[model samples]
Target: MNFDDQPHRRLNQLTGEWVLVSPHRTKRPWQGQEEESDRATLPKYDPACYLCPGNERAGGAVNDQYDGVFVFTNDFSALLPESPDSQPVADGLFVAEPEPGLCRVICYSPRHDLNMARLGTERVAAVVDAWCREYEELGVREDIGYVQIFENRGSVMGCSNPHPHGQIWATGATPMYPASEDARQAVHLREQGSCLLCRYMEQELASSERLIFENDSFVVVVPFWAIWPFETMVLPKVHMTSISEMEGKQRLDLADALVRLGIRYDNLFQTSFPYSMGIHQRPTDGGNYPHWHWHMHFYPPLLRSRSVKKFMVGFEMMAMPQRDLTAEAAAARLRELSETHYLESL
Candidate 1:
């Protein structure tokens, strides 16, 4: 079947969800308004920015004037570290439980204007190292079951602070998505006698249609069931359950893969693409998850241009999620974009 010219559905093995892909819809011309890209050059250091080094945060916490990577507990954390433990109260019709966790913010760079694409691979690798450290520290806690490392980039993604940083939210229980993935992977392993994503990665490598880029250790692809227009997943070439297992050189390769993907995203529409990127790994609840395989997902909203974005509305909200662009088509566009940032050309 001609997937690029037809309407079809793809299954998301991780989440057990299906996305409808209508590739022919791309031909429809858009008469929509475009958002004004924030082209104003930001200063290297914003003294007023709370995340900047040596600045006083709103919570009256003073940041250390350290260089390179920096990490601190969130001044206004969503999850509290000192919440009292209580069993889930079941009162026939209603039930509730107390959740305890820790939230931390990791500053990717001291520079306020730099992001993953502009910061280069070495700096991104440092961020990766910081992620590993936070995961290891938080996972050892008896109360923490999962460590979620994620970044929200650009004002469009509702990122309050533009400073180069990401967050780690370690929770007392495995969240819904990860729990679902764990179940799926476990079932896949039991039924197929192998890891789900590892086998899927091999399939993608053999097909090469949905693949964007690959290095010595990692491969980036627009997943077969991507909901967003340019959603991409980064998977380690080897079968691994967590980032903690990565060797030094493998981490460097992952960093390089991220930077290259970031550069391509920026060059795609000549804008610093906004997306919510996160890593999904095995739960830290201490269960042996030999079936789990770690992967990072980049879910970008941009559809046709910088301003045009896909929204979850109407059918997507009341029914199942859908997308106009096919995964193969999105991968092709990403594949064609330059690895160098657009600003570098000028």
Candidate 2:
């Protein structure tokens, strides 16, 4: 079947959800909203920015003057280490439970102007190392069940700051999405005797259609069931359950993949591409999950241009997630984009 030219639904094997893709709709004119891209240059250090080194944050805490990767408990953490430890209370229809967790922010660089895209591979590798270390430390905690590391870039993605940083939220209970993925991977392993993403990666490698860029350790691809306009997944070439499993070379390779992908994203539309990126790994809830395979997901909003973005509203919110661009087509566009950032290319 010609998926690129027809309307079809693709199954997200990890989540048991379907994404409706109507490739024909791409030909239609878009009279929708167009955002004004932020092209203003950011200073390397902003005294007013709370995340800058040595600056006093809103929480009235002074940051240390660290030169490289810096991590600390979030001044305003979404999750706290302390909470009432009690069983879920049930009274008639209402039920509630106390959730205890810890949230931390990791600054990728001392230079606020440099993001992952602009940061060299060495710098990016430091970020990866920090990620692995954070995962290992946080995952070992008896109270922590899941450690979620994610970054929200650009104002459109609800990122309040432009500083190069990401967050880690370790929770007492696993979140819904990761839990669903764990279930699916477990079932896949039990039924097929192989990792779900490993099998899926084998297929993606076989048919290079959906692949964007790949290194020795990782490959970036627009998933078969991508809902975003340029959604990409970074899968390890080898089977692994968590980031802590990464060795020296694997860490460098993964860093290379991230920087290269970030450059392509920025070069695609000649802007610092906005997206939400996160890592999903094994749960810390003490399960021998050989089925779990760690992967990174990048969900970008841009559609045809830097200003034009995909919006999830109406049917997408009421019904199911849908997209106009086919995954193959998106892959082709990204694959061809110059890895050199557009600003630098000029």
Candidate 3:
């Protein structure tokens, strides 16, 4: 049975979850009824934009005019540092506990029109440095257990602000995804006596069918169990548990990998791509996790075109996650795109 012409379920080794891939369903045609996000022209600096440098935020806090990158605490943080400890002592069905943590925003660039793809390699490296600093700072905290660094680009991804930025949510407890990964990685280490991601990276490198791009330090590939059409994972070449472990040269290589993938993404649909990007790493729970290997995931919702996007509904909401494209097909499409930014051609 050829997987390209059949429907099959793929297992995600990290989370031990399964995804349905219907490669034959790609033959279906769309009615062009999907929602299209605005691709309007943006200025280098918008005086009214709150995230722009020197602009006053909604909470009456003014941003500094510093260059390069900036970091600030979220005015409306979902998690707080001073959450009171409270939990039900009884082992009941509706038990609850206090979730204490911190949230901060990292402005990738001062230019409002620029995203990571167009930020240039140097500026992207600066952004990477800021990420490393924030991760280390938060990881050393006594109250923080996991630091989630993620970015939701474009308005379609629920990003209210147009400025290029990402948020960090440091929690006092390990979240569901990371917790699942930890348990699976621990189990794999016990059985195979090796890091799970490290071994998986080796396998992907040997196969090279689903790989999109790679650098001296990082490799980008569409995961075997990818649910989104163009979902990609960036894995470090070496075994490292978190961004804090990256050295000077590895950080620059990561920036290079990100820029190449971002450019390919924009060139694919000939528009500013919309996606949710995040980093997955070991929990900062003060425990040694030799099994963990840090990685980044980019889950782009676009399916066939710039206007059309893959939506998670019906079965995905109530049952299992599904997708129409195969990881190899998606990787091939991305790999064929030029690394040079499309706008740079003009």
Candidate 4:
């Protein structure tokens, strides 16, 4: 089949979802000259940064001298332990439920200058361990049903601080997005007698076109139906429904994959890449999710350079998500990037 001649193809998996892949588009790489001048360097430590050691936070609480990974309640939490009882308000057209959850921040490193790429595998592994511990602790809460660990990097991603860190939100109910995926996977597993994501991972491995990197226990690839330009997913080669279930070796491999992929992202434009990344796993509400697969999704906005970003406007907001570049092409570009950051070796 001449992929270039085809307008678009909707590849359907065992699950009823479809991804629109337009292979004919020629997404010419943008060369924005202004990005060269806009590159900024972050300091190793900032005296005023709240996340740093000995700095006073918003409520007069001070950060301790945390040398490695640090976990703390968010200074300005979106959700608190003592939220007022749920008050459901219903009108003819309006309805709402009180949203309740706990928000915490995990500092990836003490050094403000260090991003994920420069954090090294050992330190990244430490962060992974912290995540596992947090997940275990939060998941046991009788009220909590879901735990979300996510990172928003770079100023373009609206991150107020340059410190390498991520946020965790443990909620009382499963989110709509993950709930949909869970329902789909459950249906597929009941019908096919196999895990949905495990089968998808096998298919991706066999296709090889979208694969970027692989370790003993993980595979980093651009999904065939990616919406963002540099969107990628990291899947565990071995089927595990949640982070808590991962073996020590698999956990370490996850750390390595994250570090390597993050370094590649930074090297892509010779700038700190802006991205929203998070892990997707089975709900903590406790049901046999043998069919569910754990994975990570990275959505970066930078399309041409550090300054230029892809906007989800017009057709995307009204119609559906669209991308200028094909997933295969983007995968190839990411595959070609070096895992080692250029700045780190210097």
Tell me each candidate's RMSD, in Å, in order: 1.4, 1.6, 1.8, 2.2
Model 1 weakest lDDT span, ten residues long: 33-42
lDDT (CA) per prediction = 0.91, 0.92, 0.91, 0.84
lDDT of 4 at 310: 82
Best by lDDT: 2
Instruction: Encode model 3's per-residue lDDT on 1-346: one tens digit a residue.
Output: 6779899999999999999988998888767754443355689999999999999999999999968899999999999875455554556676667888989999998899998999988999999999999999999999999999999998789999879999999999999988998899999999999999889989999999999878899999999889899999999999999999999999999999888899999888878899999999999989998889999989999887887889999999999999988999999999999988888866
Candidate 2: list runs displaced more than 4 Å. Answer: 30-39, 84-87
* lDDT by residue (tens digit), candidate 2, 244-309: 999999999999999999999987877788999999999998879899999999999988778788
For each candidate, how many residue pairs have backbone atoms clashing (under 3 Å)?
0, 0, 0, 0
Measured with C-alpha atoms, the lDDT of residue 315 in candidate 3 is 94
Clashing pairs in 4: none
Candidate 4 residue lDDT tens string, 124-220: 9999999999999999887788999999998889899889999999888888778877888899899999988888889999999999989999999
- Model 3 alpha-carbon miss at residue 340, Å: 1.2
TM agreement with the true structure for every prediction? 0.97, 0.96, 0.96, 0.93
**Residue lDDT tens for model 1, 1-346:** 7898888888999989998888888899878876654465678999999999999999999999968999999988989875555568889989888788989999998899888999988999988998998899999999999999999998889899889899999999998988999999999999999989988999999999999989999999999989999999999999989999999999999999999999999888888789999999999998999999999999888886787788999999998999988888899999999887878755
Q: Which one is best on TM-score?
A: 1
TM-score, cand. 4: 0.93
- C-alpha lDDT of residue 191 in model 1: 98
